[model samples]
Target chain A: MVLWIGGRAQGKLALAMQKWPEAKILDVSETDAKGKEELLRSLEDALKDERLVWNHFHLFVRRALLLGMEPSEIWEKVASFVDERPDLVVICDEIGNGIVPMEPEERRYREETGRMLCKLAAKADCVERIFCGIPVRIK
Target chain B: MMILIVGGSGCGKSAYAEKRIMELSLDGAMRYYLATMQVYGEEGRRKVQRHVELRKNKGMLTIEQTRDVSEALPKMQEGSKVVLLEDLGNLVANEMFGEDGAMTPWEIVADKIVMQLRQMNSSLDHLVIVSNNVFEDGIDYEEGTRDYLRALGMVNAELAGDATQVVEVVAGIPLMVKGKE
Candidate 1:
């Protein structure tokens, strides 16, 4: 299982599918971010089964971490709905340079996301970033 | 009859072929000039046009891709056996490689070329191929040049495999390598 994250145009998921044929995939997007409080709360509720969760983007991981959640604990929580499945992939958009975020929320999002990527990349077996339709191995 | 026609640079391979075709006076025969050179520049473009103009009659057909054994096969006319392939060295030297200017896997390329030659052997009546015989003066070569020579060696082996006649054209002289007359 692998986690793919990139911007709107990045074919991270597509690259993952091509690279890892054996992996089963799950995707979460901004569309699911309609209601933040409800979504986060509901996500916590859904993470009860204690199965392995391959986290893609930094949002859910960041949320749980900020809420004093450990990586193993967060993965354990999400495991419940994930069929107690041994492995899975999580994805998110990491490098979106559309426009410099003038707002506080946007800046925080950027900083936190960058930090999360750096941390995950060090621990993960394989870490990649897609730019201009080509994948670059970062870790 | 099988022969290997070899000559020095610009020793009249095209002219030799046209005269041979006219001399044979092949009735209802197909005369094809299998060309390997691709015209990416002015020199190439003009040279190719000159080859087309060198033809004696409208019976002459030009097959551009000489490197490809497969493409070279289909251009052969039905019921017409006599075939002429000119400047094989350029074709074998150039194509069948990648954009990095590196040669592709010669084993794979050799297999494909050999397979096509087999098909031609069974289909065509008489085959006349022209080569530059670059073996005269060997020089220090980089990886690409070395790979090309190896591939060319494979091509030579494959062509020699089915050729009943091999003639080496040297200084306007035809030296028979494996032919009866």
Candidate 2:
């Protein structure tokens, strides 16, 4: 699996689309996957495609949280799906660099996002960080 | 040599910049910490105090100059001087909206700040500038904040072009965008 992580609006999706023009994109941001089961179903369906790009993976994590799923549980399900699809491309935003949010939900979201990215970065075969539209390979 | 370090808030850019300056400082080379942040409130004071504590025994003299960074050039001791401007964001804000700041267009302000920085760079042996990546939030800010971002972005671009090295620190990991490591 390949992982591309960066801050918001850094052209990560654009670069991913350009790199794999034929890949089927499953943008979690546009999905209505309200719970863990539905989210997994979507992932399973996307896996039917040979090449896949998972856009806005950060939002998926957030949705999982809002749907009352534990971070660890979400990670386990997501990890297995990614492991099953070696050709999967994950695009997520690095959202932990900003100030600590006043809202508890925001704080939890930021923390969970960082944790998931760290695990994904370690698991992915290739990892790149997009900085102001420049892709720098980190791993 | 001029190095520009960019990063988002709390990504450890400041710590990385500090370590880099220490590594780059030569023996007998005077190090100056050009603090451009103007302490405005209790929070700001606390932040400054924390930074002050961090720099202890680093062998760098701190010079608090919020605006017109070139003004500090005359105060440095005669030697090979290495200066670290704590950040460009605060400097831009101070120059654009501070009590003594210029009440002009952001483009003009950007040009003026860049000129001052170039002048400052010419006088120092090594200059390290710390900057922020506040542009990535995707939020639609008001016109004033947008202008601020424009000014800061222009300054960052111009400085990056002139700098020998440009780095973006993410989670304390230094990603080299330009020049040799």
CA error at residue A11 for candidate 2, angstroms:
13
Candidate 1 residue lDDT tens string, A27-110: 333325444455456554434433323434555655555555545565555545343443444555653333446766555555
lDDT of 2 at B166: 89
Which lDDT value does model 1 have at A57? Answer: 56
Among the numbered candidates, top lDDT falls to: 2
lDDT scores for all predictions? 0.55, 0.84
For all candidates in order, state the fraction of native interface contacts they contain. Answer: 0.00, 0.07
Where model 1 places Cα greater than 4 Å from the true spot, the runs are: A1-139, B21-25, B56-58, B75-77, B100-102
TM-score of chain A of 1: 0.54
For model 2, state the Cα shift of residue B57 in Å.
2.1
TM-score per prediction, in order, is: 0.50, 0.59
RMSD for each of the candidates: 19.9, 7.2
lDDT per residue (tens digit) for residues A85-137 in model 2? 98889998777765677888888888898889899989999999876556778
